[model samples]
Target chain A: MQLISAACWSTYRIFVAYILSLAFGIFYGVSANVSPKREKFMIALLDVLQSVPILGFFPVAIAFFAAVFQGQRIGLELAAIFLIFTSQAWNIAFGVYETIKTLPREFGEVSKAFNFGPDFTVRRVYLPAMIPTIVFNSGVSMANGWYFLMASEIISLGNKQVKLPGLGSTMMSYLAQGNIWGVIASIGTIVLINALLQIFIFRPLVRWSELFQYNATGSAPEWPTVVDVLSGLGRALRIDTFLVSLVSLGNRAYGKVAKYVIYGIGTIVAAAVGYLLYWLFTPPYPWDILVQIPTALTVTAMRVIAAVVISVLLALPFVIRSVRNVQTAQNIYSLASILGSIPAVIFYPPIVALGGRSYMELLSILLLLTGSFWYALFNMSKGAMLLPGVLTEMSQVFNIKGWLYYKNVLIPAILPPLITGALTAWGGAWNASIVAEHVQFGDQVYSIPGIGSLLTEATSNTKALVLTVLCMTVLIVLVNMLFWRPWYSRSAEKYNITE
Target chain B: MALLDIKNLNLTFRENGKELTVLENINFSLNEGEFLCLVGPSGSGKSTILRIVSGILNQYTGEVLYKDQPNPQPNPNVSMVFQSFALIPWLTVQENIELVLEARGINPRQRVRTALKYIDMVGLDSFEDAYPRELSGGMKQRVGIARALAVEPEILLMDEPFSALDVLTAADLREQVVNLWQEKKLPLKSVLMVTHNMEEAVFLADRIIVLSARPAHIMGEVSVDLPRPRDSRDKAFEDILDKVYSMILSSRLGK
Candidate 1:
């Protein structure tokens, strides 16, 4: 019955998160599809949401929710779900927006030609086209839920740390007690549940999406049934017919309240920025608190080097193994996924028990390096192998063999994916290192002089001044410009191998 | 003597949990240096016939003979140009042609040289280093033909190779293909092509094999004895086209 209760809670929260995120996604998608002007705003909002880690808002949410729902079970649960909701929301919205915007040109023209009502158009043309995307995003949303589980369950606000009763809290409690078996059990349970859900539900849903699976050749190995079921639902509901009607009605009501809504949003954002700027200017600390600038630079340099070296070493052998033999590679991929889901914090106690705090920090840093590198290498090797068979056959025919194959064929083919994967891995490792360094269990204390540690200390101390500065200056403008800019430009030029 | 012989071929495919025969009791014999065009509407098992002969589709039950012998091996000497052009988009014109050599383990430098010769022959010498994306439809078809010939295959199977091109480009390409066949004395023992275009069949094929509607069989075969470089304006060519067109139309309307 406890298991049933847990399942029920899990299913309800998941469904609520799913539906809310989907509704938001559809609203954003419809607006983007209907109005060209709204597209940029929608995309920008989604970008900001994606870049802002949901955990970053935990402090704000905890403070707000505690005040609002002081004695309610629903309030605490809702607060816990809010972070998960935020984490899952952006991906789902982006997926829907992409689906709607990229619907076949013919469908759009047909809707216009028929002069269908806006409601009819949306119901018939748009929603049906998006079934596969919805299913795909749901799977991704569920995946994102695993990442946010621990953080959502445990929130340290001022002198009090609230622990919510869920898998996340259980893991945290076991880890804090330095109970190795308990930690293992929780991680094992979470992994098992996720694996089962993925295999049974998500995979099947994806498979049922026949419209998207038109030419089922060379589709990346997906658990397909989730998409398949979503498609079946879309068909059963006659959503395509309804979308056509909605589109027609939407066309008629296009400009109504649109300008006022835009202005209202613009005003709020401007006021927030203005307030933040004022706060920044009135800081009590010496502007030399910016000594952390060079400190950050040094940490970044160390992190990148560690990440690159470790990632390459770990990935190289696995990649080679996978390329030479596919089954081994698949096993590695599955194991990596399970490992990837288990948070860096979860590894703290075991490492501390073995090597003490300082050694654990070093070990975590190395693990961080491995985590980043393996992901990139595995993806790169897979991407290279997954290049259209016809292209591969062409390479084979050219007598491009052995080391020459790596140099001329695999290297050129996999370079872009490798770069992108490396960039993603680097981002992931940096984030992990921060949490890994700051959080410790057992008879050890470890600190890494990095942004992650800064984030940890700031949150712990309730240092709003540093938080705001880091969020605005370091996290957004500098990080994107310095780290992600070059990669984004290269991605635009080269990553379109599929087309 | 027949260069290739396919006897009582039966091909079945599953649809909605039931086995549907795509090709049944299909028999054909082709002589050396013969150009046979299999003309049919879409899904007439014309492509299936070619696939079966090429050994890509081994699900069919039948005997396909090569040089009057029971086929013990899949036809390695057969090269096919798919309806989609199937040009490896990442490869350059020269490299695309060189693929056959590389696959067969030819030296790189020599492969490039041999590849360039064919690239020039296809009037794409200037585009040798340019990827398939850079090439026009006709140019890609030229590369396709060159790749097929590079392997020195005994039989060439072209599945609507020119159908995707504009009429002028298709006609121009057809002319070049015929010219190359005449000049090179290439060891193309037989050519089996699937096309819907009546004039294309008449122009290129020695024997035009017409296929019935879906679940297709050979309706009939017409021999075009017109001389080489048969003009589109020529009366004999028009007559052959009209006859094939009427046959196809009647078959579709009602036999």
Candidate 2:
């Protein structure tokens, strides 16, 4: 019963946050596109915010919202929703903005000649244009959000944990009690809920929104039963026109002054980030334990770099095979993902039984591969399969064969999605490292001296967790600024198809 | 008296704080039952002048009077056909027409009744339920024309409406447009079309206004005196096409 209510609360919280995020993301995205200045600063700001890991801010959110709502349940719920918003909103905003920016020049003239008002444009133009991308990104964001959901539901500040009623808390408690079956049950529940959300929400939406895609081709799949019922409800209620009227009203409300109001929002967010930085450096409460976060970060960074290199080397053959025979590769990919989801911790006991003949760091590296490597395998194979037929034929036509063909013709073609997959895979490894570097399976332990272990040990103290997480965040910001941003821009400039 | 009139039109666009005039010294008027074609070389701003007249563009020094009234903002009655068709793909053909009716504050049931006539006129009666993506290029332009005609505008503005189509499709769509005009089935009176096809202008237009290269001004005007179902092989039609060809070519060199 407690589990049920927790699930309900999670659903309600997501619903509220989803609607608000979708609205604001789409609005701000279109605004950024249409606004004369292009809002490049605003776009950069969103990118930086996305790198600030949600779990890292638990101490700040819990303390701030707990006080603001006077220690209320609603306050904690709001805090969790805000954390989910951080994961969910940015890509949706970027997706909408990018879609709007890519709209044909004639569409702009059509809008002008037709005199499409802000309200009509939102309903008829922007909303329709962005829905496909928004649906896709939401699926991705939801997957990431579940990882943070586990961290958020049970906020452990100085070991005085405030447990929320959710699958996340249920899983945590079950895991702590060493009841593997109960943890499995909770995992099953979460997966079932996620599947239901996908089938009813994403599948139907993804299918429906495909019509709005600029390069839309082929027949759309049949609508799910949920869509049929919903469309019936909509028709009975005359919902489409009614929603248009409502949106236009909202549009009229924001007329002329919307940009200034948006500017005010950007300022508030900048100030909030500054304040959080200040608090992180000078925590009001001191930690009992000392954590050498910089050293830990370096240790983890080296491990991550190694994991990324190894994964690419191993995953390359599969991608190459997929480039030849796409059908078999698709089958292999789906099968592999299903097998991969069986957690690495499940096999830790057997691996540990083999003893010090194999290195402990190798065990952690293997565990990291379980969590991160599959993303690259899946994305790279898909990317390779999608390589244009003409590209391959042209290589043959030009007498380019063997490794030379792959090096000159294929490598640059697959680089964009390959890089994207690696970036996300590295991020997943960073998150999974908190578990990967230290493993406890069936009374057996295999530990490594890395930032994950540092974070795990710091969990017992409030200030240390905050300070350590803050240090990791600062390191991330620096890496993104000096390395990732430049690499991403350059890769896109060189390899990405312009038209 | 003219159905629509423009005088002393001058337009400039600022890029990196540098002002470049796009159109200048544009003067023209449309009579109640005339088909006017504005033809020129690419980048000659014939489309800009049309955009200015339709009230879609406001940053210009000009007199754009509709029936001699100086009203600004997009004139609801001044509808346009775009080169790309520009149909909202998410909406069905029927709903696309109904959307205009709804904007005009027509009742729901009545909107369907009014939309059907234009859809039938465009010969898309069977395709009212189809989306734009499902339609052919020629069929999509029919929707674009139907949509413009749906508003019951006094004058229609087409900005290179047939440029994106293949030669065969363009020819078919052109005949249908001239058929609609000749049959006098619709409320529309005059059309101000933007095109670069010298032959097409001679074929469809009552008066072809040739524009000079950018900072575009009226360079020459030729009035086609040929009858309906114009034959390109006829000496009279050939002469008209030849004259339009020279006017546009000379202007291109004059730039």
Candidate 3:
């Protein structure tokens, strides 16, 4: 009966958390993608968010949320939702950004040439392009959310420990009490339910979207009513289609108004820049939290460097191998995708078992680091594969091999992908560290002294503190300035093959 | 006297549960310094013959004898310039040429020197550090030529190298190629090229071998008696071009 109740609560939390995170993710991701200037900043922010684990943010989330609604009883739910939101937001945003940036130019040009305008473009073009990518990210993010669901529900700060009677809280309670059977049963039940949900719900959605892939090859398959519903919405809005038709009608009636179209774009750009600048100056929290920025900035710098070094080490060999041989390269991709989908927590049990979770908790930390490493590897390999076969043949004909080959050809070939992956993985490591630092096995708890552990302690004691919020904001800015800026500038200067 | 010899070459490609023969019982031989043009209708295995002779393709029944010795496999001794100016876009003109030197473990300064010499040789010295994408189509082909030259190959095989260029550029590139061939004839001992343009074939080739339609065999061989630095408008060149063009067109109709 308890298990049944626990299952119900877990389901409810996962569903609510997934939906909220996915929504915020899509909004940020899509917006950043369309606005090229915003993309770097948004992606940097996401990287910092992803790198810091869910448990680490709980303290600040609780503190801020609790202060706003001092007497409110739904603080626990809000905290849970926010944790899921941050966990998924970065990934979803990344998915959106990646999809948008990679969308076929021909498709975009074709839409524009036909005078589809903004409304028709978003409905018929952008949304359709984003669906498959969005779904993939959502599935991956839900898996990420589950890793910390147990930690998120039970708030512990110094003397105040609150269990919200959800599956997460129940699992924590069972684990704390050394209930072996209960932990096993919970993990098993969660996995089974999730697998079933995937097979029944998500897989079919993914398969359905494969029909759209044919459009790129000029042989679009029958898409069913989804496209119709979107087209209908576009028509009802009469925004892009209506405005464009009106413009076309005017062009026929009175010959040309390109200035008005240009003015509309100018206005949109002005509004976006104004909004971004405002956000940059405004602190999400009070002035007191802003004072703690320097320490947080230093910590973030250390973390970003550590993540980059670790992830590159893991990704480099695989990338080189993939570039040298095509068949092995494909296999490497499949391996990365499988590993990428699995949550970082799966490594925790073996890590704690093997390494005792000390500062030299080398194995666990490596595993934690690899959660991001695999992501970098996947993107790097894909980018390397994109190097034109003709270019490769030229390299071979010229006999460019080994270090020179990598330095002159392969490095330049995959630099953009490498930087992008490194940033994304840096974000992933931040999130993974939260779960990695805090390990509970057989009535013994071990934690490393970092933001992850601090967050865990803050949440455990239910101390509504602004520590996490302050740390995250500082980390985001520092990452952009210290890492992404130099990298992005270098990429822009080096790889701009404007044909 | 033969620099390269093909002994009874037969090529087949397997697709969708059936083996399709593209080249059947092909035979040819060429002496040192001779320019050979393998011409036929598209899909008559002209490119396949270059690929096989260059050792790019090995799934065939044939012996490509190099200096009276059968070529075993693809190697650097034979270099091919693809129809698509296969220049590595990321590398600069100098770096692209230096790649072969690097792979061969030549000293960095010496490699740069040699690469620069070749870049200058191809008249791209000013654009030595420019990327392939930044260069014109003709310039990219020059880089391709320089890259092949840097390898110090015994036989130079070109697969419709001028096809992707504009007519004026193609003519200009052809003139530059013949001049280079006259000037530095050591590395490129013999040239075997595939061309759809009959004029290009007639102007460059000593002997133009035409293949029959698919399951391609030697249909005929036309020897170009035109002198060195041959004019495209020369009666002999035009007559050979007309004959080869009709043969290719008639072969297509036959297919």
Candidate 4:
């Protein structure tokens, strides 16, 4: 009974967070693409925000919400939701923005030719065009939501901890009590929920969204009977029509005041950043905390590199096998998607128990691997699958085998997605470092010297926490701009295959 | 009065800090009950002229007049068929037609009726519920035609309508288009088509306008006075075809 209730609470939190993320994602995406001028600023801002680890927002969430609500339950709930929002919203918004940015010119012409108003165009054209992207990204966003939901439900700031009544806190309490059976049961429930969500919701959604794809070739796959029944129910209830009307109404209202709202938001964001800068540079600053940032960043960067390297090594075999066999590729994709959704936090207690203090470094790497490895595997497999068949045939005809084949053909073929995956894994490893570098079990606390550990340790001091987050954000964004972006685009340009 | 008129239409594009003139003083007219074709070399801004008349492009000098009025905005009486057959892939043939009708505030029942009528007119009688991706290139263009016609427009602008299709399909669609015009099966008063194919223009057009290469200006216009179902092998048809070809080629050579 306790487990069931806890599961419900956890599910409720995830559902609410997902809804909020979807709304903000569509709004942000549309706003970003409203004009070229806004696109530059909005895209750059999103890039910076996306690089910041989800945990980096914890201090700000607590500082604002906890202060505003005066440590009430509502404040912590909102903080938890905000943390999940940070985890899920960025990629979704990016997906929507990209869909809008790349929409075919003829569709826009058709809309204009038909004299579609803003509301009608959005309802019929823009929204439909974005549906496929939104649906695909929703699955990834939900997975991220789960990971952060587990991390956020049991928030710890120095000695003070606020635990919410969810599966995450339930599992934490079970571990604290050394109730192995209880922890296993909670994990079982989580796995069950993930399976149910995949089977009932996301699978049908993916199938349905295929209809919305432009230039979609070949016949669509058959959907399950449940989808038919659900669609029938929706039709009977006039749900689709109701939703379309709602969008039209909302867009009409938004169109009237969107300009002023954008300006208001710009002013508010500027003021907030100005205030944050002012607070950071005030006299009697935490110079000691500032001094630790460089070394801590170096340590975390090394670990992130190690994590990405290990993930690449581990994922290469699977990628090769999956590429060679279609059946194996499909199986691997399904299994990875399911396994990848399981949060790495679930394994923390077990690793802590086994390793204690001596194996902290090894266990940290293991946890980081769990967090980062799937991105490499998924992307590399996708890249390999997308390899033009003629290249392989050419290699066979030319008798290019063994190391020669891998070096010249395979390596170049997968280079773009490989780089993409590695970049994402790099970011994932950095985010995982927060939970990986520091582990707390009951009365014992295990720590490593890294930016993550520094940030976690400074949670009690809002100023120190803010400063560490800022430093990490700056470092990550700089690395992405200076290194990853250039490499990614270069590889994409060089290795692009046209069929 | 001309059904549609373009007077000194000029378009220039600013790219990489350099001003590139795309169209220079293009002039043409489409009369009621006439099939007009604009023939030119590829990238000679022939399709750009169609886009202007369709109201998809408006940043140009001079004016586009419908019924001798200064029409600058998109007119509901003007409908277009695209080279790529821009049917919304998600919507079925029926729904794609209805979408335009819906936008024009046609009631649901009337939308279905008008959409079906055009769908049947294009001989897509049983493919009402089929999405664009499911149809062949020819069928998709048929849907595009049906969609444009369902609006009951006075002017039809086709931008290389059959260029994306296989040769046999393009021939069949061209015949069907001529049939539709000759049989008065649609509410269309005039059609202005843009194509680079001299043979295609001779086969279907009542009048052909030849354009020069980039920074395009009208080189000349050829009027076809052939009988119904004009054969490409007929002497008159080939003569007009030769005339259009020479006009385009001579302009290319700065003659």
> Which prediction has the highest DockQ against the true structure?
4
- The whole-model lDDT of each prediction reads 0.66, 0.74, 0.67, 0.83
Considering every candidate listed, which one attains the maximal lDDT?
4
Error of 3 at B171 (Å): 22
Residue-wise lDDT of candidate 3 within A1-499, one digit each (tens)?
7877887886787788776665565566666664455566667666566655455556657766767777265876777677766766677777777677766554443232223355445555666667766655566566666656666677653358777666677766676676868867776667766676666555555444544331222122344455466557857886445433432342332224655774677799889867755654565533443344456445544654587678877788888777735455556654554445444464365458556755435654565575577668766875665556666788889998888987888788788878877876766676666666667666568875555555555453222233454466556557666877588669956884322
- Candidate ranking under DockQ, highest first, comes to 4, 2, 1, 3
List, for all models, the DockQ compared with the true complex: 0.02, 0.46, 0.01, 0.70
What is the lDDT ranking, best to worst? 4, 2, 3, 1
Say which candidate scores most in TM-score.
4
Report, in order, each candidate's fnat.
Answer: 0.00, 0.48, 0.00, 0.73
Candidate 4 on A139-229: residue-level lDDT in tens? 6677777776677798764468889999889987887788989988987887788878777776666666768878556665455677788
Q: Write the per-residue lDDT of candidate 1 for residues A1-499, one digit (tens) a residue.
A: 3334443455466567766777676766676666676677667666666655455556677777877888366667788788778856776676678667655543443233223335645654566567666765565466556656777777765677777776677767767776778767777666787677656664455454423421224223443555567568977996555555444444544465855776787899899878866776575644433456457546744765587667855676666555534446445544554455555556665665567655754776765664365457545655544455555677678877788877766655666656645654655465455565565555555666665555665553344434533553345435555766566557536744543
**DockQ value of candidate 4:** 0.70
Decoy 2 TM-score against native: 0.83
Consecutive 10-residue window with the lowest summed lDDT within model 3 chain A:
A212-221
| Cα lDDT over the full model 2 | 0.74
- Residue range B203-250, candidate 1, lDDT tens digits: 998999888887777777789999998887899999999889888887
> Per-residue lDDT of A319-399 in model 2, one digit per residue for the tens?
888874646554545444334433444445446546542577877777677656866776677567667777888888999
Q: First chain TM-score in every candidate?
A: 0.78, 0.76, 0.67, 0.87
What shift in Å separates residue A101 of candidate 1 from its native position after superposition? Answer: 6.3
lDDT of 4: 0.83
What does the interface RMSD come to for each candidate?
Answer: 19.9, 2.0, 20.2, 1.2
